[model samples]
Target: MDNVKKRAAELLKSEAVKVVIGYTMGTNGKPRAAFIQNAEDVDSLIFNAQCVQNLAVYLSKAEIKQLGKPAIVAPLNVLRAIIQLASEMQIQENELIVLGVSPDGELIDFQNFSAIEKYLEDFNMEVDAKEKETLEKISSMSLEERWKFWNEELAECFKCYACRAACPMCYCHKCAVEQNKPQWIPVAAHRLGNLEWHIMRAMHLAGRCVNCDACHEACPKGINLNFLTKLMLNDAQEEFGYTGVTLKEGNLLSTFKTNDQENFIQ
Candidate 1:
């Protein structure tokens, strides 16, 4: 933690970055996002298991871009998000600095996104035991059983939109749910509305989602919306073998190939 503080201070003191986005002490001794602009403020910055929020979400924000250039203290998920963002043209190269955190709590001074991608080659997209068990339980269900199970979960959602807000990939200027002219989705939080909202959001994030669990973390009702997107991610990986962050021109879902499987053509 001290090392991170030192580096952050050095960068800010040298004006290498206009801001250093990382975790800091919040109320009740918790952790939250901290935008450190001054060298002295680096003391508040921290990194740990409790600092679970993916700070990469701010990279796409117009307000954050106004800060000149940012140095984001990124975890593994945030690293993946950065590469994915770069691939989607959401962010350009040399736009910001990345303060990457390794698994052993060491700071990796990634000079560029390509280096992060090479580092990511060794790390597997492994989920925790709890998440693995939950996915297994869901996968064991029959089609009708799965439908019934998910509906029960979705019924509790009151459309707070915390899930959408927390997602880094959901950086659209205007969301489909917010559109009223075509009425893409109903305004109310009814069963149909909730169903459509989540399904559409999952499809939109099919290959784009990095399984950061930001949606799950931000859910006021503890709804596991991350699971739905995770399923979509799994489907894309299993079918297309997409690595989520190819640093390519187009996204997996947006691009099509002649050799793609026609199983869904019907």
Candidate 2:
């Protein structure tokens, strides 16, 4: 953590970065996001297993971008988000600096975000053994059973929009749910409205979600919503040969190819 603090201070002192977005020990004995803008404040920065918030979300914020050449302390999720965001042209390569943190809570020495992305090649986005078992259990169900399962699960949502707020990929200035002119999605917080919201969100995140699990984590209802995005991601990989955040490839949905399969239309 000292190495991170030292580099962060050096960057701030040298004006290499106007701000250092990192984690700090919160009053509730947990980690919280900290925007360190001065050299002396680098001591407030911390990184550990408890630091799970995806700081990369701020990369798209107009205020953060206006600060100029910001430096971010990126965990694996943040790193993945950065690559996906960069690929989507949501952010420029030279616009920010990265302080990469490993899963074991060690700071990595990366020359640039590109090098950080290269480092990410070693990681996999798939869920763990327990989660895989759960996914398989869901897969075993018939279509009607699956529908019944999801219908029961999604019935808990209260229209808080916590999932959308937590997702780093959901960076649209105006979300589809907010469209009042056409009244896209129902305003009520019932099961149907909740189901529509989750389905639309999953489709929007088809080729962009990094499997970060932030949405699931942030949900007050404790919905296993991560599975929906993971389903879309796996489908993108199987159907389009696109692995969402490959960094070298374009988005699975946006990139058109003549050889893409159309058998599903039949």
Q: Rate the local accuracy (lDDT) of all candidates.
A: 0.85, 0.85
| Model 2 stretches with alpha carbons more than 4 Å out | none
lDDT of 2 at 74: 86
Please write out the lDDT profile of model 1 over residues 25-88, one tens digit for every residue: 8998878999989999888887778877888999988888898899989889899989988888
Q: What stretches of model 1 exceed 4 Å from their correct place?
A: 126-133, 262-266
Model 2 / residue 13 / CA error / Å: 1.3
TM-score of 2: 0.92
Alpha carbon lDDT at 14, candidate 1: 95
The superposed Cα distance between candidate 1 and the true structure at residue 46, in angstroms, equals 0.8
